[model samples]
Target: MRALTGHPLRPVTEMSPQRVLLVNLACMGAPALLIIQGVLQHGKVDWFAAGLGCITLFALVALRMFDLVSQVHDKARQLDAVAHIDALTALPNRRAWDLELSRRIAAARRHGSPVVVAILDLDHFKKYNDEHGHQGGDNLLSSAAAAWRGQLRPEDLLARYGGEEFGAIFDQSKLADADRIIERLQAVNPLGQTFSAGAAQWNGSETAEELLARADVALYAAKAAGRNRVYVSSIR
Candidate 1:
């Protein structure tokens, strides 16, 4: 029984919930038929046999309930991935960006580490999309995401903020260090495209929203001055 339990039933546990339920029904049916037959023949119930059957049925029901719970947990994980991931570029989406920014800011406050937030916008993306079809634009975005991600450190997080725009958090980096890294990103810009970026270092006393707003101000400044340049926010 120990050998059979270790080897034969191992595969059964991996079977689908429907198949296991059907197997359980079949096993229970045989015991039920026997119990009914004994009662009819002897004009008496088999208490010991009835007790064993009940135990078997209870165990099978518990297994089915556990399988259902596991399935629900898997589905929940899939939904979380969909909510936080960008379908196009395969990067973290804006919802994920906000969450990560807040988390990183909290960590920086606790550890007294520098953190930089940057926003990058492709120069003349609307015109690019107009010239090329949407498919081409999408390919460009995917390629650029891959390229930029390769240039950054593993700890740095780059996310898709919105259409043709990206957001990044540089962990333990000052504004100048982040600026240099963004320059590297620009150097490897895909498909002859260019981007403008704005970066702000955390000033020891600012909310995530305030830091992002400062970065956003610098981003617009880059766009206004001329496209294809990096601007560090003047806000200390």
Candidate 2:
């Protein structure tokens, strides 16, 4: 709705409880005026109108209460999103990756499905920062994340592990598929830059920590051998 000045009215979610109370108080004024009129006019009272006015006041109060509840739910939704998101890359942050890993590992163990965990590191990333500055580095990460995520399945999760590093978890995937996906991510251009990835297929016997640790070791080897390639760990 537009206000009298032709500006769009603020959404109820943006309104504070105090503002809602003020609006409800304004609505109550009309009914309250009628009730006061009834009481002051000598002995004969309009019982029906008085009851209706009371109902109106009660309804306004109820609506304000519902609005307050909606605001609470809105806050929770926003907090949940903020907690999981990486501000720079718009990818899931490390905390979100950890939570997802734990949940998916439990399910994989129950169903005997293989899961793949990989760590991705930007190749010569520090050199890029030295040449282009921090903002440039952040842009590179964001570009890389968007490009990689566009190719991912809905169920696949990619997260920012830390500076110049990323994490990915693929459900029901074998080592071969993980290798292919990692290669694809390497090919995605982060401003004509490249990355190195180390992928491991979970053996169903190791914890999530072990899986990530093994992937990290493989990543180290990838950097050791040469950068801009994927190294697969057959940990199973």
Candidate 3:
């Protein structure tokens, strides 16, 4: 329609309020010429009517165009938010936690500070599901995630690692710090439950996966030792 009317069409991204003004001015150019010609060459169109019609059309088009742009911006923000959030627990997901861990580890290595990784598994979670049903277990896990989230610092990263398992990355801390965190988590009961956790400190050379694996081993040891305590890796 714009091309047929002798107005140049630009791509949507190239559009701006100034460009919209230029396009409207360009459209008005034709009607202004036509109105002048009608006065000089005898009436073919009315000058006042043509100018008013052109201004009104331009106003409506510009309004619609800006409305569409605002909608696109809002949708982009919504998608970015969904990417970082875990739908089930409403906590940070694994990907978000990995990014946090990377930043913390970089700062710790530079400043000779400690960062701790703790991997948590619900004690006898499979047996709990078998005895209490899957829905009951899910309610417990959700309650547990909420409990741990409350214990975290603003810089801490807590995520659902998998079925009956969760993890955290704590900045400026050691493996021993997990004892207090574990105690806080165990004190409350939606189902009279407890967690087994393994913790290990970042050693400068270890990747996040390696750190998590060491924590997992400690978690196994804690589970073996009794199912309600925190264990620092004996190897590290």
Top lDDT model: 1
| Global lDDT of model 3 | 0.77
* lDDT on C-alpha atoms for all candidate structures: 0.88, 0.84, 0.77
TM-score of each: 0.84, 0.82, 0.74
Give one digit per residue, the lDDT tens place, for model 1 in 1-236.
12212322222245779987887686777577676878787857666676777788778778877976776665566667778888899899999999999999999999999999999999999888999989989988999999999999989999999999999999999998899999999999999999999999999989999999999999999999988999998657
Stretches of candidate 1 exceeding 4 Å from the true structure: 1-44
Model 2, position 97: C-alpha lDDT score: 93
Q: Of the candidates shown, which would achieve the greatest TM-score relative to the real structure?
A: 1
Candidate with the larger lDDT of 1 and 3:
1
lDDT of 2 by residue, 1-236 (tens): 01122332235555679977888687777677676776798656677776787788778779878877876666666667778888888788899899999999999999999899999999999999989999888889989999999878878899999999999999889889888887777667669998888889888889999999999999999999988888889776
Q: Which candidate order results from sorting by TM-score in descending order?
A: 1, 2, 3
lDDT for 78 (candidate 2): 66
TM-score of 1: 0.84
RMSD of 3: 9.9
